[model samples]
Target: MSAERQLTVLSREWCHLCHDLIEALKPLQAEFGFGLQVVDVDADEALEARWNELVPVLLEGEVEICHHFLDEGAVRAHFQRIG
Candidate 1:
């Protein structure tokens, strides 16, 4: 992992997709040791406003990995390229 590279999953409360993502990514984080930050959009007003409709967004620094849907293949590919 790059010293400065980290993964953040933006999500919100009562989001089943977010739950699914957390379930799906547990292994990846465990395997590759990617720093994962799951932020609940609803927890903060600013986050809620910015990402209220963009929940489940994956971010590597300022670059977006994907959004709404979790594409495991794409995510793995991104990690490989960025790792």
Candidate 2:
């Protein structure tokens, strides 16, 4: 799969929800064989501004998938669509 097919998680190191989302995505990443990129939103000014309160945002390229939680159904649907 291409990089665009990977899931990007915008998060902050101090956010518990961010950690939880990453943990939740582990099995899905394995099952779907998709790459998962975790980025600290606080590391970038723009990202931090846009996603500060919405840390743990899941994205497929520029498309927002979910925030503060892992939406398994949406994730599975994304895989289905990509495949």
Candidate 2: list runs displaced more than 4 Å: 1-4
lDDT scores for all predictions? Answer: 0.80, 0.86
Clashing pairs in 1: none
Backbone N/Cα/C clashes per model: 0, 0
Model 1 scores worst on lDDT over the 10 consecutive residues at 1-10
lDDT, model 2, position 50: 86
Distance (Å) between predicted and true CA of 8, model 1?
1.0
- Residue range 31-66, candidate 1, lDDT tens digits: 777788888878889877877787888887777888
TM-score of each: 0.79, 0.89
lDDT of 1: 0.80
Candidate 1 off by > 4 Å:
2-5
Kindly list the per-residue Cα lDDT of model 2 for residues 6-82, writing each as its tens digit.
88999888899899999999888778777889999888999988888877899988888889899999988877787
